[model samples]
Target: MLNRLSIRSIFLPTLVGVALLASVGCQEVPVTGRNAINLVDDQDISKKAAEEFASIKKMQRASRNPAQIRIVEQIGRRLSKTVFWDVPHADWEFAVFHAPGVMNAFAMPGGKVGVFSGLIDFCENEDQLASVIAHEIAHVAARHTHEKYSQGWMLKPLGAATSIGIGTTIGGTGIYVPSVGSTAGGGVTAITQSAFDRGKELEADHIGLIYMAKAGYDPRQSLRLLQRMEEDIASKGGPTANGWLANHPSFPQRQIRINELMDEAMSHYEKGEVSRTHTVIE
Candidate 1:
C-alpha cells in the first residue's frame, strides 16, 4: 500500500503536470476575449465534426422548401463572412433539417450548421432566424467544443486523484470507501461541468449577438426570440430556468445579458452594411 509520502509525491507531480498543460493550452476566445484551455487540435476536431455532420444529415430529413433553404443559406452566407476572420479555416456549410415541433439549431466545428424547420417556422422574421444561426456559429468561433474536450481530458486525472485521496484517507480505518470518493467526485464534476456549459451558452449568446449585428441583422431580435421561447415553454409546462443541471441559462438570464450588451451590438449594427432586407417566413 502507498504511504502518505508516496501519495504526496504522486499528487505533487500530477498537479505540476496539469499546470504545465494549462499554461500551454490557454487561448483567447474571440469576441468575449476570455482565456480558454483548448489542448485538442482544431484540424482533428473539425475532421470529426465533418464526419458527424454527414452522419446527422443521413439520419434526418433535409428540408425541401426552396424558401426555407434560400433564407438559411442567405443568412448563413452573411454570418459566415462576418465571422471569417475569427474562423478563418472554416469550410462553411448550412442545411435545414425537417423536424416539425423541434425548435433547435446547432453548429459544429469547421462551420457545419444545421437548422431545424420548426425553428425556422417559429421565427417571426428572418432576423430572428439569423439570431439563432449566429448563436450556433458563435459556438464554433469560440471553440467551445475544443474546450469541452480539453476539460474532459483534464478532469479524468483529477477524478482519479480524488479517488486515490479518498481511499488513502479511509483505507486505514477499514470502513467502506470504494465508491465514496468516486460518487462525490462525480457529483462535483457534474455540477462544475453544468456551470461551465451554462457559461459557455451565455458567452455564445454574447458572441452571436455581435455576429448577427456585424452581419447586418438586428441584435434586438435575439432578445425577442428568447422571450417568445420562454413564453412557449411556460405555456407548455416545460422545465424552468432554475434547474441546476441545465446546460443553457434561463431565457430571462439570457435576455438580461443580451440587454447588457445591446449598445455595443447596436453600434456594430449601425456601422455594418445591410446584406439583406427582412423577409417574412410563411
Candidate 2:
C-alpha cells in the first residue's frame, strides 16, 4: 500500500518534522541520559504506541496458559519495577499473546510489553526470555522507537530525494524511475537502514544487560542466550526469522561485545538471585 504512495507525500511531512526538531531541540533518553534527535514529542510517541498496543491486543488472541501468563508477568513486574521511579506517569502492562509461529515480541512506548508464545517456546529458559524482554525494555527506555521516528523524518525523505536524483541521472525520468532505478534506490535504502540499526542493537544490548542484572538475572546468561541464537543462525545458515534478527548484528560479533559488559552487569548480581521460573512450552 505504501508503495503506491508518491515519494513526495512521504517526504514532505518528514521534512516538516525535521524542521520542528530544529526549533524544539532534542530529548534526553532515560538511564543513558543521551540526547537523541527527538523530532516527535515523547508523550505523543508514548500515546501512539499505547494505541498501537491496544490495537494489537484487540486483533491477537492472548495465551490462556496460566504458567505462560504467570512467568511473563512475574519477570515483567520485576524488571519494570527497577525503572518505575525514574519513569513517571508510566502505565506498565504485560501480556503474552498466543500467536503460533510468530517469533516476535516488543516493549512499546508507554511501557506496554507483549510476549509471543513462539518466543517463549523457542527460549530454553527464563534467562533467554529475560534477555529478549530486557532488550525490548531498553529499546523503550532509550527511546529507540522515537529516535527512529526522528531519523525517518529527517533522513528517509532526503534519501528519497537522493534516490530521485540518482534515478534522474540514470534514466532521465526525473522523480520517476525505471525498474533498474528502483532496484538501485532500494539498495541505497537497505544499506542506510542496516547502518542505523547496528548502533541501536549495540546500545540495546548494553543497556539491557544492566537491566537484566539489576532484576536479579545473571548477566552471563545473556551471553548464553546470544550464543544459542548464534547456533540457531548457524543451523539455518543465516538469520532466518524476520524483524528482530533481520538487522541485528551478527550473533558472534554481538556476543563478543556483550561479553565485554559482563563484569559491569555481574556486579549488580548477588550469590543468590530471585528470577522467574519458566518451563518452555515446546
Candidate 3:
C-alpha cells in the first residue's frame, strides 16, 4: 500500500535514475581519459568550416607557386593521415597564403588548415614545417576549440539550467563569445589573453611532439623549431605589444619545455608505430 508521499518519493528516484543513465551514455575521448559532451554535431562545424574556407580562398592570395603549394599539401596530407586515420573522410584541406609578413599557421575546425608563406621563410626545412603541422594537428585532434567553446558555454547559461556534469562538452556548436569572460565582465584583456595563449602553446607543444613522433618525424624537430622561434624573437630586440610573439610564452621558457618533452616523445617513437614518407618539396 503506497501513500501519496511514498509514491512521490519513488517517482523522484526513478526519474533521477533514468537521467543518470542517459548522461552516462555519452562518448569518451581517446588518450585524454575524459568523457565528452558533444551536443553540437561535428558535421555542423565541418559545414561551417568548408563555407569559411571557400571565403578565405576568395579573399586570401593563395601561393602561385605550384611547387610550393604541392609541398605544403604533401606534408599536410601525410601528417593528417597519420593522426586521423580513424576519421577517413575528414575533408582536410591545406592552403598556403602568399603573405610573407605573417609567419603563422592555423588549423581550423573540420580539417581546414592554413599556412602563411611567411612561416615558410621562418622554417628552414621540412622537419620544421612538420613540427608546426604536428602542433596544429594536435590542436585539432585534441579538439581544443570545442573544449574552449564548451568551457564558456557550460559556465554560462547551461550551468544555470543544468547540473555540472563531469563531461560538460568536448566538441559542440554554440554562438562564439567574444571573450572567455564576455558576459560576466570586461572581455579577456590582452595581458590575460597572452597568458592563455601561452598555455595553449605549451599544451600544443607537448602534444604536438607526440604527434610528430607518432607520424615518424624526429621529435627533436620540435625542440629545434622552438630554438629558431626564440632566435627570431631576439632578432626583434624586444617583444611588440601586438604581435604573435608577444602572445606566447617567453622564448626561453618554451625552449626548456620543448627539450623536456622531447625525451618522452622519443619513447613514443621507439614503439615504432608511426608511418614515414619523405619527398623533396622542389
RMSD (Å) per prediction: 10.6, 10.8, 9.2
Worst 10 residues of 2 by lDDT: 168-177
Q: Rank the candidates by TM-score, best first.
A: 1, 2, 3
lDDT computed for candidate 1 = 0.73
Clashing pairs in 3: none
Instruction: Give me the displacement of residue 129 in model 2, in angstroms.
Output: 0.9
Best by TM-score: 1
On a 0 to 1 TM-score scale, where does candidate 1 land against the true structure?
A: 0.80
Give the per-residue Cα lDDT of candidate 3 at 246. Answer: 54
Question: For residues 22-82, could you state the per-residue lDDT of candidate 3 as single tens digits?
Answer: 6633444433435644443467656766676676667667888776687687778668867
Q: Give all TM-scores, in the order shown.
A: 0.80, 0.73, 0.70
In candidate 2, what are the lDDT values of residues 184-207, reduced to their tens digit? 333222212232377777888888
Compose the digit string of candidate 1's lDDT tens values, residues 102-137: 566667788888777778888999999999889888
- lDDT of model 1 at position 234: 67
| TM-score for candidate 3, residues paired by index | 0.70
The count of residue-pair clashes in candidate 3 stands at 0
**Candidate 1: clashing pairs of residues:** none
Report lDDT per candidate: 0.73, 0.64, 0.59
Give candidate 1's error at residue 18 in angstroms: 2.8
Worst 10 residues of 3 by lDDT: 170-179
